[model samples]
Target: MKDATQTIRRATFAYSQLYARTAAREIKHPVEGVVQGEIPRWLRGSFLVNGPGQASVGPDRYRHAFDGLALLREFILSDGRAWYRHRFLQSETFQRNHRDGRIVVSEFGTAASANPCGGVLQRFISHLSLVGDFTDNALVNVTPIGDQLCALTESPFLHRVDARTLDTMGRSDLRNVASLHTIAAHPHTYDGCTYLVGTRFTPPRPKYVILRFPKSEEMNGCKSFLESARVMAEVPMSSRLYPSYIHSFAITENWLVLLEQSLIINLPRLLLSKPMGAQGFVSCMKFDPERKTRFHIVDRKTGALHSANIETEPLFVFHHVNAFEQQGSQEVVIDVCAYVDDALIRSMYVYFDGWTPKTRFAQVRRFVLRLQPGRSSVSSQLIRPMRSFCEGGLRGDMPRINELFNGRPYRYAYLLSQADDHREDDIFLSKLDLDSGRWLRWHCADWVPSEPVMVPRPGSEAEDDGVLLSPLVHASDECRRALVVVDATTFRQLAFVEFFTDCAAPATFHGCFVQAP
Candidate 1:
């Protein structure tokens, strides 16, 4: 009976997906035109009727303090009513201060959310400057070139700019060179080289490629330094389906571990049917320059590569995957939140082993490090109101989690949870026990913390080892965002520096922290 029920559910989901796709196609027709009008009062007031009794409807009439509804309404009222017709504004950019005390930041523009007349409109928009100004699929690196800082937007063509003046210094196009996505520095190991990894999207199946750029004559006055550049290796997989690469890469002496994650959606057949559910999984590919790229089990084995797929049961939609050293063992951990029934629950310190399977492409073992009641909160009524029309819908907000080092035995992980009446969206720093599953938490006092950037201590030997530097926005004034420093090990407050301008909404992008040499 159970097997029969599951089969029926799967069939229903597949049908729904087809129907949703069809509806999406029809709505996308140009004739419907884009409707840029206020989200009707009925929709705005819907929050009040559906929200919990304790829900504090701000001046904008929304439960949350962030006036996203008002922003959406303003976008609708604007004259630009066509598809992709909204103006973009400069939002937040991730920055890293290098050892030399120079700052490198990726500047981009953002757009306000809006509803269209009759189309499958995107609820979220990517930063416009990244897509519009920079070439599609450009690997942009902003760093110090010589005496001046330069922005090197590479898409085959490399454009250099003076970091201080933001002036163009030089331009060189490498258009023939496929494309690169992830870029990283080799800490103190490489004097004048930047390592980059990217997948070749235009091919039989996307293959991972690694390249190295050395300081060259062309980069002399251009601001940055690279001695030489060469392709390291191309990683190929037997599977016909392309692997969806994660945003970051883990580099080791002998291997380059890349995390590939994806979500499988099962839709029902009926028209207007809702999605049944989704499953998420991740795999690790170990690439060695001397040998072919191989797949490894996340847990339970040694360095042996496996061929089987490792499924993360009870999918926790995640964004970041990080690898760090803990208790003398190299451990890889992913931060994710799963939807339990209707409410979203936070889970941290998920660990994986490096054991491999007998089959070449076999499955690997993975384990979630169980920590003491760390950041576990019952679903709040404010955000999970039963009467709300979109009550059970996904929040559409991606949780941010990153590593912080304080020169201690245990590593620290930071996460921000939805705010409550007594405590605003508070920051919780967890001291993680990667092996034993024991952990402790430190909640920031009187401040809502944004995603944190782990900045290395001024004289630290390891680049990966650093203190946690985060932008904390006071709950009282959402616009008043400041940079706060915390001890990664103890989660102790160190320093808070106010910024001149208001910081934009938090993002999931990794940030760099450079110290003046």
Candidate 2:
């Protein structure tokens, strides 16, 4: 009787594993090339440019675990045919220096691999490559002592590199620092000195510190600078509360806004797992330069941290946040892609008035600008229906918004739409009109397009109209990637640079467009 009971238990476990494997594959892979005829004619051009074939394993990886009986069951039920593969594609560029004509880009890559049991792992590792002479993501400090760019990697140390040659000029590693998540440069207009905001994580808590660098060309050669640096503020997570992580940040002349995102924990990793319900929140703290004290703390209910405004309400769950300060007023804009039911739903364009000391966090107002789809006239082709299979909703009608940044004369946000057949991805560029709260579809592409960078035209200000450089994956090879430049104002194709790499997949993170000055 005991032997029979054990056999029956084993059989039941095996059956469950097989069922889970089928559900996982079904949720991931769908039929491709189903919506060729539904695409608009005007938008169906060479949307993606292919790059050179380069095989490099992406820096990020996740562990797939299966316990004793569960492990045996997964193997018995695994489909031998289903496999995953991905190719890398270019994303965005950022200009580091304006005086010396230096620029850099944050390159993004994608990978296709097996999902043993768990859901898709979302991780971003950017490569900082120089366009002219500037290192990617480096914050440049222009002062009378000399010009320098400060760069910090996901590693332990912060390096000061030459803004002209992109060479490492000096390095500073914080003692006992584990993960250096973010670095910010605060430039003092009066003395021309720059302050650095360095945030690091210890075991169960996070600490925020501000390092002040003297305006001198001489390297201090001091390792204790980080220790002696002022502690701006710190927030510790209670054992019951979710772990606190700094996702992103924004800074103004008088105050610095930090977005603290919460992580979910203590959930079973088995079937039908919900991660967002893991409990999350956002904490917005304003730091005053004059008083050197914490001014305000605005707590938000569960959402990813995106952008914020000193004068207005903070933007959450966004890809990018940029602020432009005018005469006495400030304008804040955000680009965000919204996800629903574990799928990319719609992209949003948000506008905030500006920061005001008297304004409470709840007093700030928010406006969600809806995006327009590609105006295609292709209706004669026999394409599959563009609707979600699980929820029975129109897929094309669903908003597939992803990321946003500056374009040219206007702020641009990007949206991604999967064809009915699920073979290709379409990218839509939307130009926002701030005054009227309207978003116009600036350009649309049929090929799988990644995030775009707004390359400023020569002699144009940061707010001026520029060109949209987008990297895309060609539908034919399933491996080739290309960079296509579109005019920001007219949405016309300006240039196409083909890369040698093949089978490059789209990236979830955002990109920056940096033009050589």
Question: Which has the greatest lDDT?
Answer: 1
lDDT per residue for candidate 1 within 1-517, as digits (tens), equals 0210021111111100110110001111111122222211211100000000110111111111111111000001112221111111111111111121221122111111122322442412212212212222112223343332323322233434332222344554333344543222111112344445555544465555655555564354533343234565665533344344333344333234444443211111111111211111111121222222222222211222322332332222233223333334332332223321211210110111362111000011122222112133222310111111111121212222232332123233344333122121223333343344344444444444434444444455543344554444343443333444455555555444443322232211122333322
Residue-wise C-alpha lDDT for candidate 2, range 1-517, written one tens digit per residue: 0210021111111101111111011112211221111221122111111112222123221111010000000000011111122211111111122222321122111112222233445211111111111122222111111243334322234444333333445555544442344343222211333344455544455454444444443236544333333333443323222322233333333333343332222212211112221101111121112221111121111111212211111222222233222233222222222122111111110111352111000001122211112222222221122211211111222111111222112343323323233221223334433344344442333243444545554455444255555545443344343445555666555544444422233222232322223
- Per-candidate Cα lDDT values, in order, are 0.28, 0.27
Write down the RMSD of all candidates, one decimal each: 19.9, 20.5
Best-matching candidate per TM-score = 1
* lDDT value, residue 42 of candidate 2: 24
> Where in model 1 is the C-alpha error above 4 Å?
1-175, 179-193, 215-228, 237-243, 264-427, 431-446, 459-466, 500-508
lDDT of 2: 0.27
Candidate 2 versus the native: TM-score? Answer: 0.42
Candidate 2 Cα outliers beyond 4 Å, as residue runs: 1-205, 208-241, 262-318, 324-424, 442-446, 500-517
- How big is the RMSD of model 1? 19.9
